[model samples]
Structures are given as structure tokens and as C-alpha cells.
Target: MSITAQLTDSVKLPNGAELVNGFAFEGRGDAARRALFHNGHELEVYDLYEVFSGERAPAVVFPVPWTGWDRGVDSVSPDATFAVFSGQRAVRAVGSDGKQLWEYRHGCWGPELGHPHTGDEQEVCRGLEHGSCRVSDDGRLVWAHVVHGADEYDWQEYWVVLDARDGHELARLPLGSAASGSHHVSHPDGLHMGLCIGMGQDGILLHWARWDGKSLTSWDVNEGLDRILMDVHNGLEGFLTVEHDGADLRLHALDGAVLAEGEPESGDDENPAGWDHCGGFVDTETIIASTVDSEEEPDRARHWILDARTLRVRGGISYPTGPIASYARPLGDGTWLTYDTRNGTLDRWTTATP
Candidate 1:
């Protein structure tokens, strides 16, 4: 029952070259404006417009270079600002329109105990595993994960919080000692943030805090869940959806009380291959997940859509030539706008209609 709509528009740059990174649509129907980020020569932004006859034109353009820039735009701030992290640099920009509002540069350090070697043997190790930059609801604070030094193999971890107004360091948290699979979740209130500290190299630890102007209160969730997805419903009621190894996917009250845990009508096995570089969220009760299949075996690849609430398989789509990147964001009209980087296309589909 899912209906899909495709919108195609190419952004023309200054040098007669066309720039495309898939259009990011905001709003609904005719009120919607598609945003394009051009990776040509340098990273530039463009505001795309549709004319009276359905022709598209570039309304504005600008530049930004924050490396290792990944998805999760909505986590940055609803006002068109984007959070980006690369190497030892973390920055947030108001798309291509505004300059870098804040930036944190980390000095180089040697490798650590549990560090994994990448690239050729002669190259210097870039210790960044995964870093995310996020903004507060009021656009007053920006949060980012900053990993430094070459000692990534050891148990030392550090992160920083920045003042979104002046780009100043507000506080720093050092996750002392060892472990793997550490994840972070920022509450929709923008005043509170959570750190899921994974211990025993296999267990998950939950720590919550309030990002007051000066300090943080240490609150811990004792449930010992493995994985957590925070503010999944766009910060509606502060409820968190959690997935654990032995337990079924459950929704917990913001206070860490289990609300509901059972197999929804759309449930399915949480496969291993799906977890790699995959992320999605629940819109109301519909859980949307986007995953890629990458096995060493030749010609084996595809993507999937699942009901996050029911955990049931809704549909499966294959990317034959592989995609450069893909992202799904919940629009207000009960539909999702997917950006497929492989073919530079934007597709809109409704979960309710599916």
C-alpha cells in the first residue's frame, strides 16, 4: 500500500558544472523547499526552487568543509543547521548559508591499546572511530564527541560540550577505563543528554545528565539494556525505545520505567548485517529502519524497511549498484523523504499508505 513519489532536480554551479548530493526537502507539498549540498571542488549549499512550470532553479549557494560529515541533520537543530565531524575537527554550520558557528580542534596524539589500524601500513592513524555533533532545541548549545590521540586501542575516552552561542567549551567528560560499543543520545529537551556506556566489552551502561550552564547531574539507568534510541518520536513525551540482547524491543518511560515490550505486528529478527552503519527512528508507532547488505560474496546486496513498533518486515528494496549514502527523516505529513546519494535522487513515501 506504500505510494512513492520521485522529485528530480539538478543544481547548476558557478563553473557550468552540476552539483548534487540528493535534495533535502522540508515542509510538505507546495510549501516544501528542497536543499542541495554540492560536494563539487568544495562543499557548498544551494537552495533549490520550483518555478511556475515545474522548472527548478538555484536560489542561493555557500561553502562549508567539516570532514567525515555524516547524516543526522535533524539532530543538529531544526533551523537548517548541520552537525559535522571529521578526524579531530568538529563543527556545526547553518547549511551553506552561514559560516561555521562553532568548531573544536584536537591536537594529535599517539595510538592507544585497542586501536584498529586502517589504510596502508605507512600512513598515520586517524584515531576517530565515530563522532556526532548535535544542537539543543533552543539553538543555544551544541554537543559533539571528540576523540584524540593514537591510543585508541586502550580504554581512554573523552567528549566535549560547546556553547552554541559563542563556540566555547562548556564542559568535558572523560570516560575513564575500557570497553567497546559506546553510544550517545541527546534528549529532546535539549537540556538533558545521555551517554550509553558499554562495559564488559559486551554490556551497556546508561548514564543521564542535565546540561546546565555549568555542570551535569549524574543519573544512571539500572536496566542494563544493550542498545538505546532516544527521542525517537521527535521528543514528544521523552520516551525511549531500547533494544537488548535477550529482551524484546521495549519502550521505556523517560524515568527508566518499562512501558511496553512485546512483538509488534511488524517484528522481525534483528540481524547482524543490518546494524552496520544503519540508523532510523519511529514516527508515532511506525518504526522505520534503513540497512545495507554487504557480504564479501560477490553480488549480494539490498536494503530493508521494517515496522519499528511491530518489528515486522514491511518491505525490502535492493540497491543493485550500491548507494553512496541514504537517509530517512519523518515529515509531518506521515511520510518519509529519503535521500539516495547513489543516483542523486529524493523519494517521498508514506508509511501509513504502505
Candidate 2:
């Protein structure tokens, strides 16, 4: 789809600047560093450090080759450094000035069925390698999922933890022997890290383990549900998980605890499958979800705001002319920002007073 932009609420930037990848980095201080991908040729890294750090601009723009697809970034060393993973290689860059420090390349996997090749051998070759990456809260360690090799015949998965200072390989744990999926998230709390496995055919598997600088404890989960939505709190004390089982949206707590579950009061389409992508946790007490009514005369998508505690719909808005690529992230300043990848633009909005 083509990238577009639209304005929803009365939230505007100082110079109407657009922010992409709302949480590109972990901490608030590093969020101001704007990373933008223009066309498929150039990747621009803008240092908004001056806007937040109150320092003079000393060479802020850095350019890197674009790989045509969305890239993921995770901060290491408590936001002093960042790990940028795209295609099959991971590069470490200094966060303060956007300087390349180190890089690592994981070899690609060849073609096979069920595992139908995507033509871009380099991208497809990783064979379920680290689709995502995360840094430890203390900034000493970095962790990611490594799909050793998963052809149509066999399935093998593992977690790779690396030393952040240098590109040193640390530990690899074989997970997904019981299940296989592509997505994973690490909730950095005390000594434990939480993992979420997104099963393409089966349901999602949730697990938790302790990270002791080198080794990892075993993983455990309470429930095995499909279409899982996950978000960990800032403190990492607990997390919010939501699942849509065709008809209703169920919300749950970490450790397999069912905190609250209910159906959408409105905006749930007859084919309620797209709820997972268009829905996420805005906060502990609030959630945002979207649905499209395709059976109608003309298909259209609508957004809904729900109360996390009551599992009730509180507000909603219909997008009759445009499509929504993602939900909004609460900015803690009474405004919300939504990234519409379809238009290649970011829109900011505000909540109405009660």
C-alpha cells in the first residue's frame, strides 16, 4: 500500500514534523531521535537530541542504505547504544550521535515449500531467525529469537542472548520444540524475561524465564490461546494480554490470570479477524481496537476505545474514507499518536473531556 497522512485531533507538532515508529527506542529520552525511511533507497536518522537535550545540533543527519521493508531498533546500554536489525543482519550504532560501531550477519536459508520462497533469498534465507530484538533493562544484555531452520519438514527455534558492549554471542535456548511461531517480546523486569510466540497456524504461546547475564531459566505459561495481544507495563510488574476468538475480545493478565474479558459493544465486524493488528493496549485501563465491515455496501474501518477494567466500549469513530494501519500510543501528555503506514504519515489526536 502507499503511504498517506490524515489529521484526526487537535494535536500538532512544533513544526508539524511527522514521527514514525513511535517507540523506536525504549526510553523516553531516546524517543526524540527520529528515524525515517524514504522510498526504498535511503534511510535517514535525525537527531532530535537538541529538542529534548537542549544542546546545539552537531551533525544530526546520518544516512544508511534502505532495505525496502520495515526495520526494528532496540536500545542497549541504557539508551547509550542501539541495535538495528533489518533483513538478516544486526548493526550496533551509538545512540548519542548515530555512529556505526559494529555489525553482525546471520546467513540465510534456501527455498522449500510450505516455506514457499519470497524470491529475496537474503530476507527469506534467515529461515525464521530473529524477526525482532530487545535490550535488557540494565543495558548489559541483548536478546532475540533465532529460528535455526524450519523447512516444510522440520521446526526448530531458539532464543539468542548477546553481550551489548561488543558483538559477543552469549546463549541460545531451544524453544518452540512444542510450538512454532515468528514473533517474540522480552519484558525486562528483575531477573526474568517474558516471551510471546506468535503461531501462524496454531495459537500463541507465552513463557517467562530468568536471565542471569549468561544462562536462561526454563519457560512457563498458564494459558495457550490464539490471536494473542500483549503489552508490558513500564514497571514490568505485570502485562496485559488480549485475544479475539472470532466473536468476543478477551483480556487477561500475565501468569495466565484472567483479569477481565468481554465483547466489543460496537465495531466488531462479522469477520472479526483483523482485531489483533488494529488493537493494542494504550494503558493499563484503556485499549484501542478497530474493525471493518466488509459485508456492507462499501467496506470501511472503524476505531473503538474501550475501558480495560470494565471491558466495555467507551467511544468510537468511523473512518469512511481512509484505512488505518496501526493504533495510537498514549503520549502521557493527554494526546495520542497513530502511525498510518498506508499513507506513510503519523497523525496526532486528543481525547474529549468527559
lDDT of each: 0.45, 0.48
State the TM-score for model 1. Answer: 0.57
lDDT of 1 by residue, 139-212 (tens): 67766555555554433455567776666888877754233334455554556766654455455656666677
Q: Root-mean-square deviation of each candidate, in angstroms?
A: 8.0, 7.1
Candidate 2, residues 1-354, lDDT tens digits: the string is: 121223444322232223422334243321343333232333333344343344333223333422433443333344434534434434343443556555544422232556554555335343342345556666676666544544535645566676776757777777653333333444534455666666556666666666676566655564455545455544325555555343456555455566666565544356443443434445556666555432221234556677766657776653434645454444323234565444444465544432
Off by over 4 Å in 1: 1-102, 107-124, 148-155, 176-186, 194-207, 218-224, 228-231, 239-247, 264-282, 289-329, 338-344, 351-354
Candidate 2 Cα misplacement greater than 4 A, ranges? 1-80, 86-130, 149-155, 177-193, 218-223, 244-250, 267-274, 293-299, 317-326, 329-334, 339-345
Q: Which residue pairs show collisions in model 2?
A: 3-342, 3-343, 3-344, 4-343, 4-344, 108-125, 109-125
User: Which candidate gets the maximum lDDT versus the true structure?
Assistant: 2
- In terms of TM-score, which candidate is strongest? 2
